[model samples]
Target chain A: MNRKLRDLGERRLVEWIVRRLEECEGASLPPGDDAADMLFRGRLLVSCDMLAASTDIPPGMDLRDAGFKAITSATSDIAAKGGKPIAYLVSLMLPPELGLESFEDLWEGFEEAAKLYGGRIVGGDLNSGREIVVDVICIGEAGRTASRLGARPGDILAVTGEFGSQAAGLHALLAGRLEDPEARRVVERFSRPMARVREALELAKTSAVTASIDSSDGLAESLYQLSELNDVGFLIDDPPISAEAERYAEKFGVSLFDLVFYGGEEYELVLTLRSKLVEKAVKAVEGVGGRLIPIGRVIEEKLIKVRWADGWRMLERRGYQHF
Target chain B: MNRKLRDLGERRLVEWIVRRLEECEGASLPPGDDAADMLFRGRLLVSCDMLAASTDIPPGMDLRDAGFKAITSATSDIAAKGGKPIAYLVSLMLPPELGLESFEDLWEGFEEAAKLYGGRIVGGDLNSGREIVVDVICIGEAGRTASRLGARPGDILAVTGEFGSQAAGLHALLAGRLEDPEARRVVERFSRPMARVREALELAKTSAVTASIDSSDGLAESLYQLSELNDVGFLIDDPPISAEAERYAEKFGVSLFDLVFYGGEEYELVLTLRSKLVEKAVKAVEGVGGRLIPIGRVIEEKLIKVRWADGWRMLERRGYQHF
Candidate 1:
């Protein structure tokens, strides 16, 4: 029996969602309280992001994936600031005709994110709208956060992992190549993208990282943002492109440069560290079972250039635009 | 000249909104940063509420009122828990056809709320959706929160202010009676509702408040919620109905009982106070330039009743259902 949301009503739906959430430890006030209570020691990191069905969810994505992306993408901002997420407050606006089983799947995706990030889904609200829109608010704590404005000349530029997999994954999914074994890796990367929370937490504790940002807005755009904010430039001798993306680019006759520089939703950490302590930072990330791939170095000139076919070429300052 | 959002692009529009925000003192990271930073001493109260143009916006309300109410209604949840709002993070999902001037008016409304609530609009995101949707997350600090589970038998039930004005105002606006002199008062209440932040804070500090809730979902529903949570009943002998609402009821031949019991969006605080310290609680609320009107008392039976012409009649457990 498929029960629709209108049959459950708003109050019962809220109660159902609340009951599904795991009990948060040390919570003075639980989900039933008027507001969730969080205890933090130092500076609090807060980030809010909205994921709408019209723009955010691509074709071949499920409601559960949307829910996971809603929380994961917002937590990416906290990961960029080098913080550990403590709690999440979600607000969902859904169409009335949605089925109850669909909502359960959507909330199951949120539960998956909570398990991965170690943050509790403390409380939230459910409202009726024209489409499925999930707005997530993540609260975390930070010590010596790495803002986008701290990179200086000669700082070593690095990333948590290889890029371009997400872009390739989307292409594979859209081309109806999901059954291909070669496409499975890239497809999983797009559907179940992981934020570099563990790497960021470990890197921030090393006292060597200067600036950081999540590469959710593509590599070229993130570099441009850092350049504009810090009044510096970047020289990338090596681009960290995933092997799966290379195979996809070769098969589909797509430019690897565009895939690596212009494609977004990678959720990799683009960061700068002290030149002298690069080895220590790499060791710290490795200690947490993560890879730190050094891409380039910060320069004095206010132009981002990458090593192309013959010589250095300027990278365009454009990325995925939401509006 | 009118400029649409598609002309400005997402990055430039974000820059425009960030520039309009007032500088927050002691904020380590501002709007452009990866995440906002807030420093608080005690338990933090976090509440998130979403407002969509289709369901939340009434017929006569402007975009400015929508913006103001979006923040005010969310802040009301924090106020109900006896928390002082410290920071707000807003996430907007807008359509591409929206004009820049209209967006400016919406931001102006948000600025107005910031000024009134003393909470800085620290950081947010802008996304493209099918319609205008605003989701607000309020972070606050509370010394002692008045949860709905704290109400006990023999407690004196009280309210921060009278109700039904908002209901009357909605009626007046829908029926095209805005030009009437008496209608202006109710219309203003409906359009520009105020949250009882000051009174809640003062009452919480007095150590006399028991359980509290915001009357946003109508007086009867709030009473039913309190009853279900605390396993106690309410006996409202003197229903605190506003004079404007009574006038509207008499003029239009509407039921005064329905207006006082079932009308919503009042933003008043329905609370229970210690029987012996009622005087102290009243004084504390008055000290903050607000009123504390005693309505009735909490009873042992788990059923809400109101005094009518002959005797007390059972008040229905119903209110505004969003779905």
Candidate 2:
């Protein structure tokens, strides 16, 4: 633990990671091979996600959470495509001064997330940089996928899970308020987000979802993206706001609407399905130990509107921007 | 061109990149989709390679060269595995102060490398970081590969191309002696290295090669690795030293042996084949417009030796260490 990465060197660091990798099923090449080999006979889904310490890791978050979040974010893309993740390639850019313990924590987080998502951490690249950067490439497979351009007017708009918790959690962490249970829950949501891979995979089996998008960007921004791509609008009567987030917002006088709509990193799926097949979709999610929360309905008006206490309010087209 | 990434924002930057992507073959989903989709029916090879600005891009090299090298390095892994690359997913961590023109150059280099390697740049992720970092994930297909652990005694050791040019080139570039033609040639080798993908692919078809490894980590180091893995030794009677490198070494009073064995980033392939099947392997490589240079033979004893001018000399197991 006292040794830094510079002392361990890149080759030994790779050896350490190889020692921790669980035997990857169906992997023809061993863990330390130059490349990971997997035989498949279907559609292949590929996505890459990057997270850096400067912008991604908040003050309260650690390297382990950063690594987990990086994998989760990449898996969320696969889930949104209705694909099951099979393997991952992680490329890390680490500062020379990073300690071996921190590096181990990061790898542990990667292992934990891969176990949770049923994928193998097959192979990756490592280099030296000014700060820690984790880039995860997810390889998945699926028979069919729900695309953002497939939405139709009169479809039910739903989410895989509640929102606003991540936003509220970020706020609570920033304010250093973890004494309250609700605040702690929200903070945990913000720190260690989970991908909706199981729910999306099960829902896809029903073939009821017309369109899908990952809500890593704010929920409102995801709605706007789907609207633009499908040339449709949404009328959201019930936003899937979290109960813990609600209590925290009420106690802190925070805007619940903003928290639910504008907060990002939710890792949920904002999707649409035929209103008639709602029962089937709900049953599929429930079968997988998940729940589908209906938030609104797709419309042809080309505008997003939310039913608030006073009247319908227009949702802006904005989300988290990297730069 | 004058605008910085911070001013352009992440959304517009992504849009610009999407606009620049070529028409990807067999891509079920469009360019801007969250994940790239492809259909295949064989063994899949996955590898990732990362290059950072501080570590990878030398003083004279630009972002475009860095991007190209990043892709080339990753493709080399696939080549060593005897795989044909199908698609690439690039993830970039850029500094906010980077210029738009530089970013364009980087993308252009990626496009150029993809074209040269006969693959599509399907999808990628972008994020802000402390410096420029390009992590490319190569998804490829292969029928079979030559493993490093397959070498046997009396196997003829060979290389796909000459060496020492890259090391000499780097020295020339660092010494600011590009005015000389030989120096410039060596420098070009250092700056723009090509992967032995075609040669390795063709050689893999012969079914005569026993072991293979990409020699990017220097020729001597590659031999040492193959030796250790196969529990064998090599008697290197001949070193494939480039003429230009030899000239540069003489002119600069540098050791030719060191230049040939210790200089890294050659991007060549070191392999071992049965002496009787050498003709078949040579024919296959030549058919693909590449040459196979015979170096020596694998020995039963587990030691690496080079036939130096004075006598046989033991080669150290050392190469580039990132830290």
Candidate 3:
């Protein structure tokens, strides 16, 4: 018999959840306590992200991908600070009619993401609501952390990985182009954007890198955030638009500039580094099987300027805004 | 000029939030990093709670109370473990049409609650959604913590404060009896329930206490939780119903038993302690301007039995279940 969630009651549901969780590395207490206990070294880094079904989850995404994306989005913030994730506390609000099998799938996705990021789910809260809402609170540790305010005017602006792929993937998914191989690849990128944890940690160990942010809110928005925090401007010589994004833009008759500059959910780390240590930063990222693409320089002027085929144009501070 | 949330955008909203938060103690890094950093001593205790508009909030409760209640609910878990709250991360999912003043009111409530609990809002995420949802992730510290699985057969079961006050208040609110002073008092109790942090901390310092849990899911439900975790049962000699609740039950022609045993959101810490040190536990609670009411005892038998005016009755394990 397929048992309904209401038949299991809250305690039985908790037991099911507890049984599924593997023993976390640094957890001192088990999952049944009022709170889970963990021992950590160095400075503690904490960030939270909430993914709502109506707002965060797009078309063609399953519950598993939603769960994975929720955790990845929060961990991406930790990566921006050059911190290694230690643990996660998830708070899930589910609809009353949600089935047990779907709940299990969501947890499986959460565990898969934790395994990929080298963190564990130590504790969480489960409640009932109108729509599915997953709030992930990630705890990380760092010896020395990067901040957006530390960039200087003469620093070189660089980013990890290509941009606009997730945006293009989202477009393709919305347009019912899921069967195409290229479209599938980009959509996969949207579903599971890799957090730059290894690359950011490597850069944090060096004195070269200064300011940093996760490019989840589009490359232009990330640049604007850094500029606002450091009171400086960015002059981009090369906008790193991925080939797939370019193709999607051409085929769909959409603005390539919009795809590259304003699209969100990239999960790439955008950083400002010392001009002389650009090669060192590049080598460190490459050592981790990642590429550091330097595209611009920070300027004293407090405006963002991008170079196109025509000439330099001032870009508006636009990206994904929840409200 | 009344500004809507969508008009202000996410960046401006964040700036508004940042300006409102005072510098929290023990936070090494500021709020803008991927995560806030905190220095701590002893074992780190972490818990999270999410409150959604459709389910959690009752009629007549404003946005400020919603925010305060959200943080308090999470901190109540920390209190159950005898931990002192250090910081909180708030993630808000707001509808776009929400006014700026209402947003400010929500933050004010969060700040007020943190100040009351001796913690601070360190960091958070703000997103758009159909309804308002607040998720609070609390981090606390403890030297020696209490757990549900530690109760012995001979342990004296005790609870902090009176039961059924919050339940009575909820009844009054739902019944549209807001004008009566007694009803108003009960409603206030439901609106602003106190977490027994100081009392729990004091109890943790002594060797008398063995097992503990917060009675957020009603008194019977809490006893069941302890019973299940410790592989034991409870013999209740006294049901800790408040005088106000009894009066309310009589006036409303409702069952007093249901009001006291199955009502939720009390935020009282239920504990099992050594019978010999019952006086010590009472005195410790009194030292913190609280009362410890001994209601039961733990037994080896795996069933919960209650002593009523009629006779001993086997209590049904029923309480509020989210699913």
Candidate 4:
């Protein structure tokens, strides 16, 4: 118990999986969250997101926060396309000498988060580790999946929350520059980044959104993804950065724009819509208390170029990769 | 490169995940697996399992085996209800210093198992570890789930494959009795278990399977589960043990019957059928090279008692709980 998860091996970690599920989340026949038995009326469209240790997690975090963030990663994917997440399942592979209750409590935390966002923890896998890897699969219903490909010329770009707070906080935490109350905010955001499932659901219900993506991989990368999916170019403007990020950048001499443009792990929803419905789209999310801020517009050109207060150039490699 | 995965923390480790999942699988919308999207149908089933290093995984195993085993733990739930697995996702939080490529290679193995079983993985999360944990979620589809609540007193009990091999092989490996070729089969069963999704699918084509439960939580425990659901009793006969298990039990001075009866994680299909179509049911699984051995029948009594060659007694501690 004295050792961290990094000191463990694969077989030694994932040995705690019980053979049978303990309970169900709903009255429906199928299980919920990670343990699911969904009845689909049509052809199924599914996807999985696997998060490894280093790139996605903040260091020295609690198991509960890690569990929350883990669900957030998968839920973010579900939120981007206007899907209502039905349930979530998780596979937690822990190191051999791990305290058993740590995982049991963590599983409960994961379940709470799923319920908080209107999803259930249905089922999951537990295995030992080369490293601690948590893989989440979220299932949702779709009349039509809002994709990044729907954006076209003149479509406006928007996000659900302020950018760069998590990024700047992450930078400050790593750089040892975070101080006092600001440190708590930055640390909290860094540790428990939330998914925008409710926001996406609201957008989908209104049918005003054209394209969408989450901010886990940063702004420019998501814009590029939208451009690729829709076969249209983008001219994203200066994104709205958090006041905390501005202050932290000033204190640490970090670039505020870089955090706004290319920082990762925000878990916010980035979407596109026609300018005509921009007000409606903004109102739809606001009624649900979900923020929607205009960032820029889709362009006719085939390249994604950003415009700041200064000048602009073609953007490249805004975030991370898993391969 | 030869280092193991347990030493890595969250940040360095998640970077490893970002590298592995650049391409989306079975995406329903654009920017697939990057954030939340539409649910593919009307509902989803969900669950989570925690893999313990000391209890779930055996020592001296390949990293890829962890990935393979993780899939089995999740998919077995789907198989229990005759659900077709559609997609899977994962979340990984690792200890500091875990090798990233080890994750890549393991993912390749996990992806291969899913493909072999006719499922795909789409998204996941990677973070740093205080302990290494791998959590997987599998999504499945069924017309009408063969629930545990449907069994009657006249139903016949059946199973798909021989049991006890994984327990015996794991015991041998842990106790240092493994040798080439002879030890390989047992070890393979332990390291690379398969879910009975195909058999479950075939079972779903008919209503003959009145109630079903996989023997993952040991045959005894699964029987109790069905009894609880149907509010009836189970009269299970002697379950089949593998030839390898028989040999290992003799060498290790343990009871082969005990292992087959009480051991879990066989990943085999089990169901309760009406006695009227027992012949047709046997033919059904046999037609697909999946054997349906009648181990017992459901009873009207409320107690779940099993019979051996000699006598019958009340069962104790029906299944294995990894905690």
* Top model number, DockQ: 2
Ranking by DockQ: 2, 1, 3, 4
Indicate whether candidate 1 or candidate 2 has the larger lDDT. 2
List model 3 lDDT by residue over A206-247, tens digit each: 778888889888988889888888899999989788998887
Q: Which ranking of candidates, highest lDDT first?
A: 2, 1, 3, 4
Interface root-mean-square deviation of model 4 in angstroms is: 7.9
lDDT tens digits by residue: candidate 3, B1-323: 78889999888888888776555555655675668886554588889988988888888777787778888899999999888898898888899998988888788888888989988888888888888889999889887777776898999999998888889988898898988887888888888888888888888777788888999889889888889888999999897888888888887788888888889888999999999999988998899888899999999998999897788988898888888
> For every candidate structure, what is the RMSD over all alpha carbons to the true structure, in angstroms?
1.6, 1.6, 1.7, 6.1
lDDT of 2 by residue, A1-323 (tens): 49999999977887787776553565666676778887788888999998888888878777788788889999999999999899898888899889999988888889889889999888888888888889999989888876777889989999998989999988998898879888888888887899999998888888889899999888998998899889999999987888888999999999999999999988999889989999899989999899898989999999999997788999987788888
Q: Mind giving the per-residue lDDT tens digits that candidate 2 earns over B249-310?
A: 99889999999999888889889999999999998999989999999999999999898788
Predicted complex 4: CAPRI docking category: acceptable
Report the CA-based lDDT of candidate 4 relative to the real structure: 0.67
State the C-alpha RMSD over the true interface residues for candidate 2, after superposing those residues: 1.2
> Could you give the TM-score of chain B for each candidate, in order?
0.96, 0.96, 0.96, 0.88
In model 4, what is chain B's TM-score?
Answer: 0.88
* Clash numbers, per candidate: 0, 1, 0, 144
Please report, in order, the local distance difference test score of every candidate based on alpha carbons. Answer: 0.86, 0.86, 0.85, 0.67
Candidate 1: pairs in clash:
none
Model 1 chain B: weakest 10-residue lDDT segment is: B21-30
Worst 10 residues of 4 chain A by lDDT: A11-20
lDDT of 1 at B234: 86
TM-score of every candidate: 0.97, 0.97, 0.97, 0.76
